[model samples]
Target: MENRPQPFHITLVRHGESVGNAEARWQGQADYPLTDTGRAQARALAERWKNENAKFDLLISSPLIRTKETSEIIAATLNVTVEFDPLWLERDNGDFSGLTAHEVRQNFTHPQFSTPYDPVGGDGEGDWELFLRAGQALQSLLKREPARYLIVSHGGLLNQFMHAVIGVAPQANNSGTRFRFGNTAFAQLMYYPHQHRWAIDRINDHAHWKDTD
Candidate 1:
């Protein structure tokens, strides 16, 4: 058997926590600024990349303020410009936009009205559909760039992207092969063009946050 060629190399980073995160509210499509702790987390991640001599050929992020802020922090240390991409935006929660988790569960009784558990409602794209589009957009972008890159996005989008790359569903406590992205965390992915698949190199790596409180 011949060795298969690897796909493009990419890194996934989740945006730092935001006010909505602290308040346990669904911020889908709602813009929220990063909290003080979130800023610290972003700084810690940036420092980690600098200390480890990490290099990125390109830096991309969701257009959302939180993701843009987080990407800027990392890009500063890398001395690279950041690109804001709408495709990288987080899931659109639609009607669930500003509702708390409890409120969503209480008000929406549909089978798919749960958090990280069920699909969201309203005029939003289905989770599966969003994943498909995001994966396609990423693949197209990788083909154009074809370089080591860093992407700062939301947790929901990250999870879906991981699933698209690894050909699996995103679940809690999955094994190392599974794709899991934490707040201000990162994962390494290599695309295998021969197999037309994206292999997971690492997931939910938070070594950058070691010194953070």
Candidate 2:
């Protein structure tokens, strides 16, 4: 009998544009439905995954409505079911919730504001803490299943996870894959169990929407 090779393919996808996202407001822990364009983006992602023909053993998403919806769309195309988890939700921005990026920078610039390494506003979970939790969660999921998986989450959350898994900080611009994932864009990562490391395979792969523009 031949031993099967370890399955370690993981795809991370940011949810489509929500109302707060389109409005340029902070959407941390805010539940918003996908906009019309967001729905289209979800469909586009589904079609792209279908064309790729890669089989995913599991589909996981943040409990947030936007991510859940997006994951559902992709899962439908893949003919799979999705598992929802709150741990995958975006960081809680605390008082900065529902504020625009400019607003967050201009008025809320506490010493700990933008630095994930510090306590978030001395109230919410620090960015580093979220990163650690995400890493742990991903590891646990993979250990339990050890198969190809898809994770649909928010941009901020996904970015943090990417930084954690790739050993890159936010300021390390050119050192790692900087993913500006548009609505429904997908990124791939491979987890090598031997090295216990996750490697970025692709970033912001939006081939499905290329011809639409």
Candidate 3:
């Protein structure tokens, strides 16, 4: 019998709530520690995985404080060490970093018309740039041997990664599709490198803490 190519099992997770999240800040690349609720969410996720007997061969995370804290909690529960990568970092929001919605409106003037190529926050990454970065991150992951990978990252990057997986280009002026990744929410995916095929098993999974804040 011919040997079948091993499929890569990837779980993309958004970090739990942070101080910035509580403050409703943009938080793009701005380091903010997880809030108390955020830590509770992480624990809940860890408990859920432990109960499910979930196993991951590799654990990767963004170095941001929020993501690092969330990943550390899960890693402790799963007995996996986390490898941090800047590529997994959140999209740089430039001038908008650590700003709230009202503050952003007060500070930056909104362009009447903008394209995906237009820089965000007057200097931050454009949609296409983030998409390209996501593609690069995906490619790097594929270079490793097929295994179960748990990635703790930000919502913006994860959304771009999903777009890359589905071959969707960035839309102009934020009119593109969006994936909602709540605190401690995750997306499970499978990739067959030999056949260049991908499967999305789940998206925005946070059943463990649906009842709680």
Candidate 4:
């Protein structure tokens, strides 16, 4: 066989719906356990991965409870121990945590406060802070090579990670890489150690739940 670099495979999974998701509340960095539907979604995701025979050397999850619960279920099915990484946690909402959209609108002066348009210096987490967290997570993952990693995380972090891996600016308006990851959606990426590059085979795929949903 040719002496080629072994690829580091990463399967990125966004945690299932949380009470905040179902209620349309600002989750920020708050810990919200999975809702009943969210638990069911995790179970289905576990079954889907099991059926596909997806194996991982390491499983990482955000410290947030929603991701923790999702990772626990999937790791149980995969028989892998989970390592909690706060870097994979969701974006910090600062003053907006645990509030509804209407509430946020009532409180914040600017319209972009709740969204990604706000600057990095905003009271809550701006794009730069979130992108830095994703960068830290990616750097940590690079230390482990030639292995499969299954990550259970949040939507914003997933988006930030994808942008980081692809080496693009985190500004959605400028870079035009605004990705939407629905609950329980996933992306598949491979890292070429020799080239120091990442290849995304899939992005924000939730096809497994298409028919079920």
Candidate 5:
């Protein structure tokens, strides 16, 4: 029998509720701090992971205030340091950044027909661009030695990351599948690089706060 290398373990977590989320604003790389409720959610998630004895060799997060706070809370509870990466930042929305939904309707015109390569908000990365960025991020992670990795990021980027993992192509005109990542929710995945395989263990797992919902 031959020894097999340990599979790469990855946990993808979305930041807790932000003011933008609460206000229905386009957050798209716009910096926003976590609300008090968001902090509480992070604490709850931290407690859940602590109770489960979850361990990770590396914890990376987007440097945005919302993700930074969420990662800090969990890292503190887990006794792990966090490394910030811009690659994990939320999708850049260009002129739509920080704008509310109602404002967007009033300020910008929506095209009835658009392609995946169409820039968002007139200048930001389109679906294809974001997908490519997500691939780059995954590649960077795979370049490192196999180990457990925890990533704290935004929903949009995380969605694209999952798409990359499952080899889902971006669809035109926002018709692609979307992964739901509520506040403090997370997905667990495993990759056997030697076998060139990936497994999605769970998605949108927020059992820690199930009772509250």
Candidate 6:
């Protein structure tokens, strides 16, 4: 008998715009509600998923209000139940939670203010640390053995997860892939059990936005 590889598909969706997004504020560890435009973006995401005939056995989201709200909208469209998980939560920004980029630069003298991929000072999370967490959380979730899954979270968290999965170096100078994750940006990946590897099918895809426009 030959050993066959088990294949699983994973989709990551960044939550839509939040009040912080509009204000250009850093929304770390803050539970902010989604904007009206954000809700419409989530609906559009669902429509795109439906149009593509996408199906998933599992739906997971961060405990943040914006993510939960976005997940709720998506889950309703896909008829899937959402399992809120703190492991997918955004990195803790500590005192910088509600500060704008300009304010953060003015307040923090740390190099992180200039190069965010380095590490934030105070009680905030380090880029490398968050990368490890994303790796661990993803490993744990895969243990459930779902064939297909959807995850809703913040852009930074999703980027960390991708870095972990792809074994990308967590360095400020890495300047890795040139992909921008706009609001409601979605990515598709596939895991191969035989190779113990994951492949990116899509990244930062936002065709849904164009469709709605």
> On a 0 to 1 TM-score scale, where does candidate 1 land against the true structure?
0.84
Q: lDDT winner between 2 and 5, please give it.
A: 5
Go through the candidates in order and give each one's C-alpha lDDT: 0.77, 0.77, 0.94, 0.83, 0.92, 0.83
Judged by whole-model lDDT over C-alpha atoms, candidate 1 comes out at: 0.77
- TM-score for each predicted model, relative to the true structure: 0.84, 0.84, 0.98, 0.90, 0.97, 0.90
Please identify which of the two predictions, 2 or 6, would achieve the higher lDDT against the true structure.
6
Cα lDDT, model 3, residue 54: 98
Each prediction's RMSD over C-alphas, in Å, is: 4.3, 3.3, 1.1, 2.7, 1.3, 2.7
Rank list by TM-score? 3, 5, 4, 6, 2, 1
Q: Which ten residues in a row are the worst by lDDT in model 5?
A: 204-213
Which structure is stronger by TM-score: 1 or 3? Answer: 3
**Model 1 Cα RMSD, 1 decimal:** 4.3
Model 3 lDDT per residue over 42-142, tens place: 99999999999999998999999999999999999989979999999999999999999899999889988888898888899989999999999999999
* Candidate with best lDDT: 3
**Model 3 residue pairs with clashes:** none
Ten-residue region with minimum lDDT total, candidate 1 = 169-178
Per-residue CA lDDT of candidate 6, range 1-213, in tens?
996866888989989888888888889878889999999999999988898888989899999999999999999998998999999999888778889999988987755233434556477887777887888778877787748889998887888788778777576643555346788988899988878877898988888885421
Q: Candidate 4 on 1-213: residue-level lDDT in tens?
A: 789978999999989889898888889888889998788888898898889898889999999999999999888888998999888888888878888888877876764324345652247678877888898999998887689999999888888888888888665433467777888988899998898877889876776676322
Residue 67 CA displacement from its true place in model 6, Å: 0.3
| Candidate 5 residue lDDT tens string, 1-213 | 998988999999999989888889999999889989899999999999899999988899999999999999999999987999999999999999999999999989999999989999999999999999999999999988999999999888999999999899899778868998989999999999889999999999988877322
- List ranges where model 6 is wrong by over 4 Å: 1-3, 112-121, 172-179, 211-213
Task: Show where candidate 1 strays beyond 4 Å.
Answer: 1-7, 112-119, 169-178, 194-197, 210-213
Question: Which has the greatest TM-score?
Answer: 3
